[model samples]
Target: MDRFLSNTVSRIDAKGRVSVPAHFRAVVQKRGYSELYALRCLDLPAMDVGGLDLLDRYEQRIAQEDPFLQTADDMSFFCHGDGTFLKLDQDGRITMTDFIREHTGISAEVAFVGRGNFFQIWE
Candidate 1:
């Protein structure tokens, strides 16, 4: 129950806010995350959404690589520099950023696909 599971589709409101699935929100709340981190997937047309643990994992992976390598810089830039912090509103919703919309191509609706520790945003 503490994991993001299953999938759901939600409509974006006039203000460009989309409700996070209740179950996914519960998982995030359980982990004491005030905001979710989102990064554009390097190999897919989706956005990876998760909490601090997810960010930590990426940091750990990046730390294992040689700092001088271009791959390390690319990963750090994509995962940290370009990441978006999504703060849930009082209604458990988040306004979609232009970065998210541009990366995911989400229009009026967005699909939330859970992936254990995280979820993916798809158009």
Candidate 2:
């Protein structure tokens, strides 16, 4: 079973901050992760989030390809360039950046869904 599982909806405060679920936070902490790597999912108007394991796997996938390859370049830019690191506050809340909040169209409420090794936040 995946460490991060289940779906929950969280409220976004006026500052665009939302609480990461306690279970998810625990899972991340157990994995020795202090932050969440997030990116605007290209295929969906949502935020894709991952811990260290997912980021490591992503790096491994990219490393298998030649640096000059188009696919590699695209993955590097999409994963590294646009990736945003969010450090959870004492209450397990992260303040979303304005750019990402606008990009995902998330306003007052957001839906958090578990996706095996990762999770996603939807408007």
Candidate 3:
């Protein structure tokens, strides 16, 4: 069974780069997520979720609910930007862009929340 794990906090550097927590990186690697998919949140109340293959299941959910309209809106909001495929450095750090940093307001202290298939970064 897939489960979400939350036990780590990451620090965002001045350049918008953060080291993926060791435990979280292990989970991501175990799930075969070498490349991550990232985008800004469309739902104002929703959290800023990230990580690899996160959209697959979400897309399925949207398709099941409103295949035409809701899905289109989701695509328009989250899929419009160039989705970043993040690669972990030797030290397990993933760099965030200025745009993402500003959008999410992520500073020195950040939360790495595991949400089953993907994870979210919260400030």
Clashes of each: 0, 0, 0
* Residue-by-residue lDDT tens digits, candidate 2, 1-123: 337799999998877799998888887887788888987787899988888676777789999999998999998888788778889999889887876778788888888888877888888
Query: What TM-score goes with each of the models?
Result: 0.97, 0.90, 0.72
TM-score of predicted structure 3: 0.72
Query: lDDT values of the candidates?
Result: 0.92, 0.84, 0.65
lDDT of 1 by residue, 1-123 (tens): 898899999999999999999999899989899899998887778999998788899999999999999999998998889999999999999988899999889989999999998999999
Give, for candidate 2, the lowest lDDT window spanning 10 residues: 50-59
Model 3 off-target regions past 4 Å? 44-52, 61-77, 80-82
RMSD (Cα, Å) of candidate 2?
1.6
Indicate the residue-level lDDT of 2 in model 3: 42
Looking at model 2, residue 53 earns an lDDT score of: 70
Off by over 4 Å in 2: none
In candidate 2, the residue pairs with backbone N, CA or C atoms under 3 Å apart (3 or more residues apart, or in different chains) clash, namely none
- How far is 49's C-alpha from truth in model 1 (Å)? 0.6
lDDT of 3 at 44: 34
Residue 122 lDDT, candidate 1, scale 0-100: 93
lDDT of 2 at 71: 96
